[model samples]
Every structure is written in structure tokens, then in C-alpha cells.
Target: MGGINLNGLFIKPPSSLLAEAYDALDPNGNITIKWDIISWTPDGYVAVVTMFNFQQYRHISAPGWTLSWTWAKKEVIWTMMGGQATDQGDCSRYKTSPPHCCKKTPSIVDLLPGTPYNQQIANCCKGGVINSWAQEPNNYGSSFQLSVGAAGTTNKTVKPPKNFTLLAPGPGYTCGPAVVGHPSKFISQDGRRVTQAMMTWNVTCTYSQFLAQKTPTCCVSLSSFYNETIVPCPTCTCGCQNNDTHPGSCVNPRSPYLASVVNGPGKNSLTPLVQCTKHMCPIRVHWHVKLNYKEYWRVKVTITNFNYRMNYSQWNLVVQHPNFDNLTQIFSFNYKPLTPYTSINDTAMLWGVKFYNDFLNQAGPMGNVQSELLFRKDKSTFTFEKGWAFPRRVYFNGDNCVMPPPEAYPHLPNAGSRLKFSIFIFFMTSLTLFFLFE
Candidate 1:
């Protein structure tokens, strides 16, 4: 009777049914559950649940689960079955064993319900939730579990290295005479005045991430005599040789002739003295005398590695000037000039130079490299003696070199005056000695 009833009912034992259900519900039995905090906000956090060995239990739906954060004292319940569900008949009702499933492959479920609980939890947290998908979280979950098994949490934090600093061309850095120009008002129109100058410097960053990022930038404000008016040249005449076309011979040609013959080129024949006051009247003659002439300038720039720990792979230096057209030569052993020399624009003249490989190879911590630029005008007899202008914009790896108060004019000796002074001193000394001996 029992066998006949069992065959008619087609019933499986209660123990066997319970065992199957238990194994299906146990994550370790047929599936593995991995829980991770994918992202979070100040109020709440988002968790991810992954299931492995999902194919083994293709008939079973993903179990309902609960995620809890101990710090915020919050809990989120996810009741959706198999993450999605269809109104299919029960598998136990069929005699063909386990029934077909909605999701038959391994799956991942983002546990963010977008509910008030998630929002409230996020608000309760101090800082915004950090996404731990790429990195581990600083704070660990007190306890985490899926309906099937408990999951582990990765609790780790990352700190960035120290920031990089520019040491060589520190604050108030200046480049000496990168551009040469006359310091007088007479040659102002000739563009011999140092209108602008540019300087290059060194920069560094501690993080390696800077390599691929945009280069750092710094602003250097230039304070110069940009607004000063050009002083007019003093009035004078060319001694006996009347340069003006106003046809009129000197009343006393012998006096003017004697002045020119005695003055020569070293002395200013046009200068008025009390002895020649009568004959030194203003004449309508313009002497094409190039006064306050500046012939050449030596520009020196130094780049130093500021960071003691980091080494530079390569670097670019750019300098701009308004009067760079006077550049005659470069004196540098470490740097190489870039192509397309002296790029000119309406604003200024740009010079790009690169230092790498051999230059950087030997440059260790606190290493320095020096470069010199020689600027000259057409005339070799004159130079920007009073003081040449510096560059207006100087950049090192796109960082500007700052300028302090303008320095005093460089000491430039006048060759003609120096020779004349030496002669006068020798003559005076000989005369004094002769008188003393007599």
C-alpha cells in the first residue's frame, strides 16, 4: 500500500527536499559570494555583490540579502529574487528535476537601491563615500554578508608623496642681461633700449603622476622702466666743420678749427668751455654723433635642481625679449638650442632651448647648469654699457621665473674716456715729480 501510494503521489521525502533547499541557500555549498564597497558618499555607501559557481545552481534564484555598515549603524535590505524575477511555476511541481532559471551565468549586482536608507547613511558619514573599486577603502565595514555567506572587506588607505618645489630660481629670481639695449634716450628710437627680457628656470614635482599631466605654471611680473619717457639728446655742434646745409662760414674759423684739431674723437669738440665761450655759440649744425652707445652684453642664466630626492628626465627653457635681435652669440656647454631659431611675433622674440641626456645625466641633487648669451649691435665700438635690459618672460618647463627689484646698472667702462684719463694721469704725475725734484 505504501509503495502504491508513493508511486501515485510521486512524492520526494521531506528530508531530501530540505537538504536541497539548505544547500541552495548556503553560499559555500554551491556558490561563492563576494562583497565589496564599490562607491560611497557622505550619507551612505554603495556595495557590490558577485556570485561565482552560479551555473551549478542554475535553477535557484539569487537569494535576498542584507548589507550593513557598522560605523553608521545602518542596514540595507535587498528583497528582489535572482535580482530579477518572472512569474514562473515552482520547480518542485515538475518531475523533470530542477527547473530553468532566470540568470544561468555568474552575475554581479550593484547593491545601491537609491533609497532614503542609502541617502541617510551617506549623510551620516563624515566625508563623501570613496569608490573602492580601483582602490581599497580607508575604513573597513564592521560586518558584511549576503544571504548565502559572509564577505571580506579590503580596508586600506593611500597617501600621496610630498609636493615638488622649484628651488633654483626661487622667489625673486632674475636673469642678467638676456637682451642688450642702449640705456640712453638718444638711441631709444633705434630699439636699443632694454624694453623687455625673459628668463628660464627649473621646476620639479614630487609625484610621478605629473609626468603625464599638464606642466606646472607660474607667473612672473616684470617691474622695469617701461613707462619712462625718452630723454632728448643734448644740443651740440660739429666744431669748425659745419654739418648743416645753411651756407654760412664760421666768423672765426681758426678758433673752431683749433678746437676740432685739439679735441679729436676722445673729447667732445661741441662742448662749451669758459675759455671758448665767445666762439662756442649754438650753430644750426647737427653732428651725427652716436652718444651713449651700447655695443655688447653678456647674459648669464643659471638653472639648479631644487629637489634633493627627485631627478628630472628632461626640461625645456623659453626666454622672450623685445630686443633679442641683437643676440650675437651663445656661450653654453650643456644646453642645445631648439629648431626654428628666434621665433618672432608682434609681442616679443622667443628662444627655446632644451637640456637633457648628457646635460641631465650628470645633474644629481642640487646640480646646476649655467648658460651665457652674448648680445651685440652693429657697431663693435659701442655696447649696452650703462645696463642692458633683461628678458620679459622666462620659463622653465612652462614655469615663470620671478623677478625682484631691478638691479643697479652694470658697470661698463668707456674705452675712449678710460684712455684719455690714463694719459692725463700719466702727464700730471710726470709734471708733479719734475716740480718736486726741482
Candidate 2:
């Protein structure tokens, strides 16, 4: 699914774009939308629509998913539950009882929590958020039921909706044309009987990072106690500052309007009004080589959120390091190994514990999460020489962070020669002293 721009062959895509194009762990990852009509109405039919996230790592965060499609016929939504249309549309045509929505192209958003029980159904009222398959498989899907009117009651007469679009809070997913598939099977809650949908149509959507953003979201920095130097994020790794419009300028931390702007409308949106910095990244990951033990080594990782406008919930980090296979213990974070290359387990998925460090706050004193990783050393491969202790690649919430070059990493000091010479001189001095005393 990860392909170059057909029109612009000269352009080279970023490694993050290519590295995430396919998930070896889940080859058929996608968010599938299914419209399953259960019963035929006098005018139309009742459909129970389901949106399932089969993607292993990608999830729909706050201000969740907004699903839209163009109705094939003059179909108007009569009643809806579990979700509501953003617009009621023009219902003036009906004098007595207006349909829930009367638009030819209706946009629907999931209802928030605490919805009325009568208006709720299975897997509804999550404020539009959907978890990824691997992180929380049980919450990977959401469902809503709706009543349709002014449409054919039979499957042969009814045509499937077209031009499905998914705004998982933002643009990046492209959905294919709805294709009628095998009838979906349903069962009673008590497990007494089984039922099947009258008709079923599915829409599978894939993601492309190129369509998501022009700039990177996060970056990485490094430090080690052995060396005084602390490597910073590469210049303009996310984006560079400019003297032009608001795009380049950052919000002042003490600005008077800060309160209003951040808590204003669309508070849950992904917009980042971050602080001023050379890297201009919304998030920064700092890895410090903390302590070394005879049989083990420890590393401290800190994730700081510079985005003052948004808060990250259920955030996760993906890292690639050869030592992850030898990971012995991790503090304040949960770890899961990923084997994308069959047997090689150099990759790891780490996230904060539930209700603890799971929420990465906005830019402030409390806007960071820290964890210590301890790994058992393999004498053959464990060495402080060069940059062997650092991670090969790091990702923050699925965004690849720019790391300092190999040459810039903290290098081990070459003090072995000085120690050897000093030992030789000491031995010579001891021999002379012994001869004089004799």
C-alpha cells in the first residue's frame, strides 16, 4: 500500500512514510465500514452500521471519527441511534415529523458518553474515538443504528452509498467504493438464535502519512553520563522557524490570550500551538544513558509535549533497538515486542500504564512522562564504544522522530592507554624504592 506519488516520480518520500506503509504484523490492517440492513421498512430499511479498526497501531483519538457518504438515491435518515448527523439537513419537505436527517450527503459523528439509554446501542457513545487493534482489540470497533426512508425496501432496488469519506478527526484515510459483500451474521444476546442481515456492504479504508502532514510531529535527543555533551534534536527536524505568518511563530507561554485560545472551540483538535524552539516539534523524546552495572544497564527516557493546545491520550511509543530482545524490566510503562521480520525481535511497542502515565499532558511543568528501561547485557554485543547503547529508531505516537547523527552521539573516552602507561610507571617506581630500601 505504500507507493510513491505516481505523478511526481522525482520526489523521494521520507523513511517514516515508507517504513509504516506496510505492517508485517498485520498485513490486512484497515478500518472497515459495514452497512448491515436487518429489517425492511415500509419506505426503506433499518441499517446497523459498524466501523471496525483492524489497523494494529493506528487509532482514532479524541474528537473521534466522522463518517460521511453520498446517498445513492433520495435517501433520508428517518431515525438514528448511537450516533447523530452533524446536520439535520432540510426537513421542510415533511410537515408532521421530520427525518433525523434529510441531506443527500449526510455527515455523521459518534455521540459522546452519557447518551440517553434509549438512544444508545452496542459499541456506541465513545465521542468518536476508536482504539487500534493491537493496543485495545476489544474497543477496536464502534456501531450505530439508523432508520432510512424514501429508499427501496428490497436489496435489488436499493443501491449502495458512494464516495465514502473518513475524517478520523483529520484527513489521511482514503476509502474505497462500497462493495456489497456476504450477508453478515448476527446472534441473540442470550445465544438462542442466529440472524443475518438482509444486505451487507463494506468500505475498507487505508492510511497514507503523506496525506496527513507536511511536517514531522516529534523528534529525539540523546545524553549520556559518560560524556558531558548532550546531543540535541537536529535543526528543522520537524520544521524551522520563520519570520512570516503564524505557521512559523509559536505562542508565548505567558501570553494573556493563552487561556482563551487553548480552551476555545475545538479544544480536542490536534492543532499544536507549541512553544518556540529551534526544532519546532510538538513533542520531544530525550534518551539518557543513566547508569551502568556489571551485568545490566539502565536508560531514562522522557517524553515532553510542547503542544499547549492538545493533550495526548493513550499515547504509545515504538522503538527499534537490538537490546530490546534482552529487556529485563521497564518502569511505569508496558512493553510489547513486535517481530516484523519473522524471528527478529528488535522492535518494541511501549505505552504508559492505564490511568497512570497514559495521558501525556499539554506543554507545562506536568507535560511529560518518564520511564527507566533496564536490559541484561550480552557480553559479546554490549559495548559502550561508539553509539551502541542508543536506539536505532524511535517513534512517538506513530510519528518518526528525527535523531542526532551517529557522529554526534556521546562517544566513550579513550583512557585505556593512559591507565596502562600509569600502571607501568608505578611498577618502575616501586622497584626503585624497593632497591633503595634494601
Best by TM-score: 2
Which lDDT tens digits does candidate 2 get at residues 106-206?
A: 99999999999999988899999998766884677888999999889898898899999999888878888998877876756665666788999888787
TM-score of each: 0.26, 0.85
Q: Provide the lDDT at 265 for model 2.
A: 72
Scored against the true structure, residue 259 in model 1 reaches a CA lDDT of 47
lDDT of each: 0.29, 0.83
Off by over 4 Å in 2: 1-27, 254-269, 414-438
lDDT tens readout by residue for model 1, 1-438: 121111011111111211322221111222222233434333333342322221111111112222211111212222222232122223453355332222222122223334334232221121112111101112211112122111222222211111112111122111111112111111134444422111111111111212312322222222122222222112121123253762232323345464453344534232222112122222111111122225655555455442222233334345555345556666543332322232542122122233423232212333555455565655633334433354444544433343323343223446786799799999999999999999
Cα misplacement distance, residue 321 of candidate 1 (Å): 3.0
